[model samples]
Target: MLKPWFALCALFLTLGAIAEPSPRQMALFNNNCVQCHLRPGVGAPLVGKAQDWQTRKAQGEDALLRHVVEGLKGMPPLGYCSACSEADFRALIRFMAGMPAGTGQ
Candidate 1:
């Protein structure tokens, strides 16, 4: 009874995870960026909306990474992902900006 329900819930969670980031990246975003990113009018870019990221994207990955590392406007230093590596930030930025892979420029 309860075992079957738990199993079904686990299956859905696994599927959801599979459709997106690796578990580590997902965990980082969940704990850090999700606080402002998924919300409206928080002054941080909204995930999955390209327009929210276009101007920033045009600045190139290096600039964006610097902003994340150094803090800019509404973003705090390290964008609050203190545990995130440069590689993690890169991938997550592209994902939020909707840029095609390797096209962060």
Candidate 2:
């Protein structure tokens, strides 16, 4: 009785914990990436533009992630998303590169 209810609650809690980033995280990504990327001559590659991303993507995902974390020629450290975790950086790279999430190098 109580055990079944507890199990169900645990399952739901686990699922919630593994769910995607909250709206706040999405907003952070948008605020940080969109501002620079969308503008021409910003040096930051525009999101969803394969041509803009090709050369960067050729550098490999690990390199790309390193650039985001450490900052490249024109990109700032943490890609300006100070609150972002490594996973968040990976997602952002994939999103910007126009690659599907979970697609590894």
Candidate 3:
């Protein structure tokens, strides 16, 4: 279970697919996304779990950002980070989805 997830994380890290948040982005994530993304079965995709984001990422950055801005299913608008701007949301989405730094703004 957890082993497979750990393996995937390692693989992504090796391939530079995992994105790291800046200190500012970290603040936003800590205040908002961590509450759900770091937990299991909370509806939001868990960070570092590539499979969780496979489809969403394939939808490309615009669609992902739209879902965040407009809210999708159990997710609230701006992912509850009302103080966040489009750039902030972009960074946060990349961080959680493990998208590479060069992609998606």
Candidate 4:
């Protein structure tokens, strides 16, 4: 009985590993952005809200990246990911923007 439960937990963990945000990216997101940005906030969910991101896509990736790097009116600069590299920032922004995980913008 315990063996089955352990196996199920292990499988779930493995599947999560293959999913979005990677460990590093996940840590970065949790630390910096989860506060105001709910998983399904009135604005958008960082995890996977395809339609919300569709509206943002029209603005272009550069605009999206710039918004994060520079900060918009309601958001603070870097959105608190100041330590994040350009590549990291790009990845994070793309992830939150509704693109599939690991899909480099």
The whole-model lDDT of each prediction reads 0.72, 0.69, 0.77, 0.63
lDDT agreement of model 2 with the native: 0.69
Which lDDT tens digits does candidate 2 get at residues 10-48? 433543433344466556766687677755687778755
Scored against the true structure, residue 90 in model 1 reaches a CA lDDT of: 82
**Ten contiguous residues minimizing lDDT sum, candidate 2:** 11-20
Estimated TM-score per prediction?
A: 0.75, 0.72, 0.80, 0.66
Ranking by lDDT: 3, 1, 2, 4
lDDT of 3 by residue, 26-105 (tens): 77877787777777888888777779999889998889999999999999888889889888888778877878776736
In candidate 2, which residue pairs clash?
A: none
- The sequence of per-residue lDDT tens digits that candidate 4 reaches over residues 1-105 is 254335435533644533355568756866787665643454544444456567777897778888888888767788888778777777767656655455544
Candidate 4: minimum summed lDDT over ten consecutive residues — where? 3-12
Off by over 4 Å in 2: 1-24
**Model 4 compared with the native: what TM-score?**
0.66
Q: Is candidate 1 or candidate 3 better by TM-score?
A: 3
lDDT of 1 by residue, 1-105 (tens): 254335435533643432244578866976788778866898998776668888988998789889989999899999788899988888777666665555532
Winner on TM-score between 3 and 4 is 3
Please report the candidate that would top TM-score against the real structure. Answer: 3
Better of 1 and 2 by TM-score: 1
